[model samples]
Each structure stands twice: as structure tokens, then as C-alpha cells.
Target: MLTTAPFTELAAQMTGRVVTASDSDWDAVRQAFNVTADLRPAAIALPRDVDDVVAAIAYARAHGLRVAPQATGHNAKPLGTLHDALLVDVRALQEVAVDPAARRVRVGGGVKWERVTPLLAEHGLAALHGSSPDVGVAGYSLGGGMGWLARKHGLQASSVTAIELVTADGRFARVDADHEPELFWALRGGNGNFGVVTAIEFAVYPVAQLYAGTLFFGLEQAGAVLCAWTALLPDLPDEMMTWIKLMRFPDIPDVPAEVRGQAFTIVFGAFLGDEEDGRALLATLHELGPAVDTFAMAPPGVLGDMAMDPNDPLPYLSATALLDELPDSGVEALVAAAGADSGSTLTMVELRHMGGALARRVPGAGARATLPGELGMFSLGVPLDEASAVTVQAELDVVSRAVAPHKVGDYPNFVEADTDARGFFDEDTWSRLRLVKALYDPSDVFRGNHPIPPADVRSL
Candidate 1:
């Protein structure tokens, strides 16, 4: 049991809400966005501003408790019951400022993509954001954010110009390429293992709108469509990006009749240019005869909604891998594992194209600036019961094994819970990350998702 003395004093110093296990709202405060993360921290503290965050960190240290800073908890699957830590909730630190003339945006720790994208749209500018609008900006960008425009502009982490963070020693510091250069590099793609980021400033493009949407086809054509898709990757223009998704709908009554219990193959695409050019470039896909096509010219915000990601939280298991190449053989393996004929419990299998600008690593950029693979493959499994969970787990295992030969590394954001951080980077990059951790947070005060331990403490 955790003593209340330090918490009591901490509450007196904070101008924010502090919920303990004894509070009436403990159940709600302790739960993460993903239902699977039933975190039971000693206490949950909501920091309203930068000062409050510093106070919370100091109080945790004073009481021999670590501070696990989280904003929306969207990627909290790996964080189990945090009984030994104080969960610092940064949702109340919502602040956004845009320099339209400079083509940059400064976002708070709590701001979501939905909130920031529309704001930038007003100025005829846009930033790189994830598929879901509900995902927190700071957390997403910190893990190397990938979006529809990534092929042209590169990862979001590479665009970061500055970050305001409260270090483990309770000091507020501004990190940029010239200031705290190593820490700045680590913070951009370093998984937020060193400090609590209060705000971040990143570059945005002068794009107002683009042609984006999905082309849907019945599952029977999945094998042929996927093979063609793989063949087209090498010829795609830098201004465009595409991904293929194979989804199996459940037989639940709530599902629409058109897709209930049936599988569908979707070819979703986005291009950053004029409508006429976009259509002309995508004409080959139209010749393939999709059952339905929803592609059209729309605002950049529409990219977040194109995937139809769940707006609310639920229990699910997800895994991802980076592939050095997605040849015909790899596509065939993907189809056999989760396509029409496979009685799989997995809900979705997606292959996102990587390269173009992603292949060019910026000089003096962060650890994630370079693309490790040509494609990123992800799988999602939703289980409603113990038996269903077992089935989904089995299918996921089979899917992983099928693509094992093509696997290289993995994107930090898409990696599963309990996965070692070493796989996300090369040997030299991992060593550099460990050294940064040792210098900034030697005691490992913040062991958040995909943690990188201090260098000297490792078992060599």
C-alpha cells in the first residue's frame, strides 16, 4: 500500500486534480484509453500547466515513486498496472499556436490531431498527423508520426524544430538542434523516455487540400489486387502514398448488411496535388474495376477519417513489422494468412508503402529519420471472449511467422507491448539512445512505453 503523506503535500502544491485510489473517481482515472490497460498507479495527477508538471515530478521523487507521464493513453498496451508509479495526466495542458507566415505550428502536450489539423487548414497549411484524429499530437510525433503525406515530407519527428520538456531533475529546458543537441535528437524519436514534454514546434506544408479516399472491392479479388498493388509501389510518385487493407467483418447484428460476416479488400490512397493530375496518375487502379470508389478531392483533415478508425476505445491486440521488401512472395503470404479463404479471427491486415522521402535521412536528424524498410505491415485482432482471444492470438502468430522472412525492423509507434526497444533501431542507434538516457535520466524515472534503459545499468 502507498502512503498518503507525500501525495497530500503534492496536492497542496498542484493547481490541478489529483485522484487517489480512495477517491470516488479512481476507477475512471486509473483506466487507460485501451480497455486492456488496467493501470492502478499509486495516484493519478493531472497537471494543468508546466509548473504543475514540475511539481508533480518533484513530489514523485520525494516519495520514492517514479513519474509516468501520459496524455491520452492511446498507446498504453505495454503499461500494465503501474502500482509503483504516479501517473501524470497531461490532458489539461491544451494550448496551440500557429505561425502561418513561417509555416509552423506549436502544439501542447494534450492537443489531438483533430484539434490541430483544422486549425492549420485555416491558414492553408498542414502538419503530419496519424490516421486517428483522437490520438495525442505530442505522443504521436514523439514516436515518429507517419501519415498520408509522409512520402513527400518525411516523418513528423523529422519536422520538429523545438520541444519544451521538464527533465527528470525538475528543470524546464528547451530542446532543439543546437540546444541540447543530443537530447533533442533523442526526444524527437526517442520514445519520451527522458522527460515530460510540455509542447512541441514542428514544420507544416503550404497544402490546402488534396485528392484522397478508398477504393473498395470484394474479398474474392484480394489476391490479384494485392499482387498488382505490390507491382505498382516502385513506380509511385513522391507526391502520392497508398496502402492496402484486408478486413473481415463480424457477424454481429450491429454490423451493416452489406459487409456483415464478409471480407472486403480496400485500396486506400492519397495524393498531394491537383485533382486532374491525381486522377490521371491513379487511372490504372480504376481499370481494375473496384466494386465501389469513394475517391474525391477533399481537405487534408479527411485523411484522418479515411481509414474509419474507431473513435472510441476498446479491447484489441495489434502487431506490426517493417519489411525490407514486399515482393510478390510476401504479398502472397499476406493473402494466405488473412485473406478470403483463411478462417482467421484477425479483423484487419494492412500494408503501407514506405520510401520516397522516407528513404532520404536528413543530416543531423533524429534516430528515426531513416526508413529501415520499404513497407510497413500491421495486423489488428479484436477478441470478445477468452476463446475468441485465443483464436485471434493464434491467427496473429501465424501471420507473424508467414512474414518472418521479410521482416527487418519496426516502426516504434506500431510495435506491440513487451517488445524490446532494440528491434526498433540498429545497434549503433540503440547504444546512442542508452547513452542519452543515462545522461538525462540515470535512475530511469520515466519508464514509459518502449522504454530505453540507461547504458551503465545494462547487463553486458
Candidate 2:
């Protein structure tokens, strides 16, 4: 059993509160965004500033405990069994500074995309943010962030100009291309293994408006819709990003009335071009005759909620894969596995178009400069009970098998479960990442969601 008595000194050293297992709000403090993730950390430090972060790291190190730096805990499921760790919750470090003139923004680690998207929209600027607006900017960027602009602008990590963090040694450091380039490269894609990130600065684009929205069809038409969508990808340009989702809308008050309690095969997209060209490009999908078409010109801010990801915590199991071009047979197999008649209770099965800028590595790029795949597939199911969990796991497995043949790799950001982080990169990149970890965090004091141990420690 853990006690607050040991944290008295640590609490006195910081302005933020230190939550222990003995505290009344321990359950609330230790909870992750994924309700299923039962995080039982030795203690949780809600750091209000960078100084408190440094103090938390020092305290954890002195007490022989590993430190896990987290903001929103979106992917906290991977940090399994945190009994020997101190979770430095940085949600209190909410800061947002946007310089529209320079096309740059610096946000505190705790800042979520929702907090910045609308502000940037007002200035006719946009960042490479993912589907959900609630995801923390720090965690999303630290992991390889992919979103609507990904096909044209590339991953959010590559756009990062600077990252400020408190390293394992309790020192504050700001790493950029010209300063600590090695660590900068690793932190962008390698995650928070070496330190606790306090803030991140990245470039935004001047996107005043674009043609974007969803095309909804009956779930029964999934196979036909998917086949047409795949065929249309070859003719699409980088400026046009699209995804097809087989979704079952829950009968909840939070969901829009029209989509509530309905299942549909939805084709959602954002095109950085005029409505005429966007409509021309999507003519094939339109010919299929969607039940409801919402295509129209909209500001970048609308893209944040376009995907309609759940904003609340829920128990769910997910599976993901990076896939090559899918043949007609592959499409049929996918439909057979998760379509309307598959008896699958999964909430969503989505395949996002990936290529163009997303597959090209530019000069001065970070460790995760490019992803390898023509499409990225992600699926999830909410398991309300033990029986439902087993059913969900089985359906997820079937969906995995459907795409297993064309599976190329996995995106670290989409990989929620704990696994070998090395698999996310090539041998050389993995080796270099380990070396950086050895140099900066030789004792392995920090624990990332996907932990990458030091080179020397790995050999042992």
C-alpha cells in the first residue's frame, strides 16, 4: 500500500498537488482517458509549471521510481502496471501562444487541439491535427500525428520547430534542429522516454477555407462503396485527403439526431481546393448516390470535429494496420468481416488514404519523417461486459485477418497496446534511438507509452 506521508516533501516543493493512493481523489487522479486502463501509479504529480515538472522528476529519481510524463493520457493503456512509476500529469500546464504572422504556435504540454484549433481558425491558419480535438497537442505531436492535412503537409512531428522539456537529470532543455538535433529527432517520434515535455512549437498553414464534409450511405453498400473509394484513390491529388468508415452510431443524446442509432458507410474528406474541383474529384462517389451529402466549403476549424470521435471516456478494444493497395478481393473480405451482415458489434472500421507527403521524407525531417503504406486501417469496439469483450476481441481479430495479407506496418500513434517499440522503426533507426536514450537517460528513469530502453540496458 502507498501513502501520502512519503510525498509530503515532494508536495511542499511544488505549487501543484501531489496525489497518492491514500488520497480521496486517487481514483479520479489516476484515471486515464480510456476507462479500461486501470493505472495504479505510486503517485501522480499534477505539475503546474516546468519547475514543478523538474521537481517531480527529481523526486521520482531520488525515490527510485520511474517517471511517466503524460498530458491527456489518450494512449495510457500501453503504460501497463505503473505501480513502480510516478505519473507526472501536466494538464495544469495550459498555455497557448499563437504568432499568426510567423505561421507558428507554441502550446504548453497540457494544451489540447480543441483549445487551439478555433483560435487558429480565426486567423485563417491550421495545424496538422488528428481526428479528435480533445487529444493533447504534446502527446499527439510526440507520437507521429496524422490527420486531414497529412497527405499534403506530412506528420505533425515533422512540423515541430522546437520542444522544451525537463530531462531525466532534472535540467530544462529546449531542443531544435540547430540545438541538440539528435535528441530533437528522437523526441519527435521516439516519444517521452528521455524527459517530460513542457511545451512544443510548430508551424501552421494559411488555410482560409476548403471543401470538406461527409457522404453517408447505407451500411449495406459498404462493399460497393469501398471498392469505388479504392479505385478513386489513384486519381486523387495530395491536397485531397479522404477516409471511409463503417460506423454504427450509438443511440445517445450526444450524437446528432440524424445519425443517431443508424449504421452507415461514410466517406469523409477535406480538400484544399475549390468546391468545383472537389466535387469533380468526388464525382464517382456522388454517382453512387449517397443518402446524405454534406460537401461544402468550410474553415479549418470544422475539420477538428468532422470525424465525430467520441469526446468522453469509454471502454473499447482497437486494432490497426498499415496496408498496401487493396484489391477487389481484399475489399470483399473486409466487408464480409465487418459489414452490416457480419454480426460484428464494432463501433467503427475505418481506412484512411495514405501517401503523397505522408510517404515522402524531406530534408531535416524527424525520425518518423514518413509512413509506409497506401492506406491506414483502424477499428474499434465498445465492450460493455465480459461476454461483449470476448465478442469484440473476436470481431477485431477477424478484421485484422481481413487486412493481414496487405499489412505493411503499424503507426506508433495508433498502436494503443504495449508492444516492442522497435518494431515501429527500421533496425538503424531503432539503434540510433537506443543510443540517444543511452546518452540522455542511461538509467532509464523516464517511461514512455512505448518504452525504448537504453542501448546498454537492452544488451543486458
Relative to the true structure, candidate 1 reaches a TM of 0.95
What TM-score does each of the candidates earn? 0.95, 0.98
- lDDT (10s digit) by residue, model 1, range 1-460: 3445637788889999888978988888776767877888889889999899999999888787878888888887776777788888899888999898988899888888888888877776778887789889988888899888889989999999999999999999998988999999998788769899999999999775588888888887888888888877788898888988898877877667877887889999898887788877777777789988888988776776677677677778777888888777877887788888887768888889988888888887897786678888889899888788888888988888778899887888987586788878888988999999999999888966888888995555
Candidate 1: global Cα-lDDT? 0.84
Alpha carbon deviation, residue 401, candidate 2 (Å): 0.2
User: Per-residue alpha-carbon lDDT of model 2 for 128-226, expressed as tens digits?
Assistant: 999999999999998889999999999999999999999999999999999999999999899889799999999999895599999999999999999
- Lowest lDDT 10-mer window, candidate 1? 1-10
The alpha-carbon lDDT assigned to residue 366 of candidate 2 equals 80
Best by TM-score: 2
* Maximum-lDDT candidate: 2
- Give me the runs in candidate 2 sitting further than 4 Å from their true place: 1-5, 457-460
- Show how many residue pairs clash in every candidate, following the order shown: 0, 0
